[model samples]
Target: MGEAIHNVIIGNGSAGNGAAITLRERDPDCRITIITMGSLPFYNRYDLPRVFRGCYDWREILVHPLSYYDDHSITLRRNSRVTDVDARSRTITFAHNEVMHYDRLLVCAGGQGYLPEELSDYRGLMSGFGSFEAAMTTYKALPAGGTLVMLGGDMIGLDLARTLIDTGYRVVLLTNEYTFWPHRIAEDERDGFIQALGHMGIEVVDGVHPVAVEEGEAGKPARRVIFDDGGDVQGDVVMPSYGLVPTAEFMLGSGVDIERGLLVDPMLHTTDKNIWAAGDVCQIWSAEDNAYRFYYGWNNVRLMGEMAARNVTGANEAFEGLEDERLRIDKKGHIASPFWEH
Candidate 1:
């Protein structure tokens, strides 16, 4: 897989975008193609909350404009979702019915929200941070002074919750765990964040689950949410986060050991030598625990992008799972691993 002629990257999310930049920098003469599911103009999900909360403008929300990439001779296929992937012939068929051959494929198809069959009745209620469309849909439907309940109160939940609250929507987040901020903030610290946001008028309800969503009469707020704890709460909207699948369904039978995610060696190369996955798509081997780990954070995508580039360009840079110390930044400047602690 040395200097593949036609390299097409799937998914234009942060991981995919970073991979493109990384690849171009390593091998300038390489012919790179990017296939994205969303429309033109890629944005950072990390900025969604800030933007919705009146923190940043649309210009600030955009990570890279089409013109910037155009100046670099990078071709973008916006709104072109790949319908099929033929690993045997190394070809991908887009929804527009165009076939493109790839010498080597780099998968940065970041995680997508999970829509379980159990909740098939309310599957339409699920959403993720994969694209700007999701952000907009959530933003437009979120009503001012109305209650929003997050089904999964992880990183995405906390972020989106902030956005809804800041935009004048009353938010109540429900999490299995008592605290939010999966290891970035401690119990006390997380509580403090929650309290501060609560001061901003957001509520965190933990240790419970939503039994069902009682929608409004055809054109109303969610109306009511039945909880397993013999209690109920009314909501204007309910959004579920995807901490499950990383939009890696295309690689289903592509010889990739996708237990929790596409498993990769220390070099960030997937089980298939001809294909490589980065960011939320690839499950990196954790040196700390000797188990496969999937990191869906921002910095993790950046690190994996460069490493995947080095590996794809015939360079032999070993892939190291994210440096936990750097990822574990506490607001109070403590060295504790708040991202994981209960």
Candidate 2:
């Protein structure tokens, strides 16, 4: 009976895809457009490690086939990177200099691998375990039985290590932390994991910080990694697994509140009333912590996207965050925690 609402969502990962579907379900007549920097539509990033290990093909990891977008009547734009956002004018400019107006905007651009200064100049020599393209590039460059120096003890690092080992590559895991998952697992559990990795022929070095990367010959990847303790290791491939940083560069001057991520309320609305944020790119208000914190993992991100969509469509659902019962599977295929609370 009234003018149709135009909803523009950034990113085509789980959060962006979930929000698009939920928005369409809630408001059938509304126009929906999903702009993504990636070339594919809505693929599962969690399967990237599997892609590297040769367990699954890149096409198999796709969450939804292209037909799904057509069936739902959602306009999906690939390779359209958002360059800037004008909150006041309710418009977004892409990397190609194309601009579009939107009635409501949802920023779910997710995150990228955090590259440390030591590895910054050697980006070409380093591979990221965070994205599909990065994983593929690293996998292609790896030679059979070649040594892989993994820098970081994060979940992605562990996953990459497992994949490389299973794929017949020698893996040396370097971590600045005292133990694997020092913050999450018990000391005994950490020790057990270290033993497990050793049994699998993977070397684990703890409390070792990387100082610099010694570049290799022309057309070759970094050959050596130097640590702060004056120790070093040579490898055919270097993979950085230092956590993820929010991909919020476009929101810099958009009048949106961004700390570690785009700050959002319990309802997933940003500082700007018409704009919302969800997934890894958003730091939602946590009642338990009395501050804004990241709610990670696939289940949490999907739920956040749905809730954000509901709020955007005037459903105004109060998000309580992910339930503890939800199972968290790390990149290594291990159930990280609380698969079933007793």
Task: RMSD for all candidates, in order, please.
Answer: 4.4, 3.8
Per-residue CA lDDT of model 2 for 105-150, tens digit only, reads: 9999998878877668877767666667777877777787888888
Model 1 poorest ten-residue lDDT run: 333-342
Please write out the lDDT profile of model 1 over residues 207-254, one tens digit for every residue. 666777667666556656677787877677777653546677767776
Q: All candidates' TM-scores?
A: 0.83, 0.88
Off by over 4 Å in 2: 1-3, 53-57, 178-201, 216-222, 323-342
In candidate 1, stretches whose alpha carbon ends up further than 4 angstroms from where it belongs are 1-4, 54-60, 115-117, 125-130, 177-201, 217-221, 242-244, 324-342
Error of 2 at 256 (Å): 1.0
Q: lDDT for model 1, on a 0 to 1 scale?
A: 0.68
lDDT of 2 at 293: 78
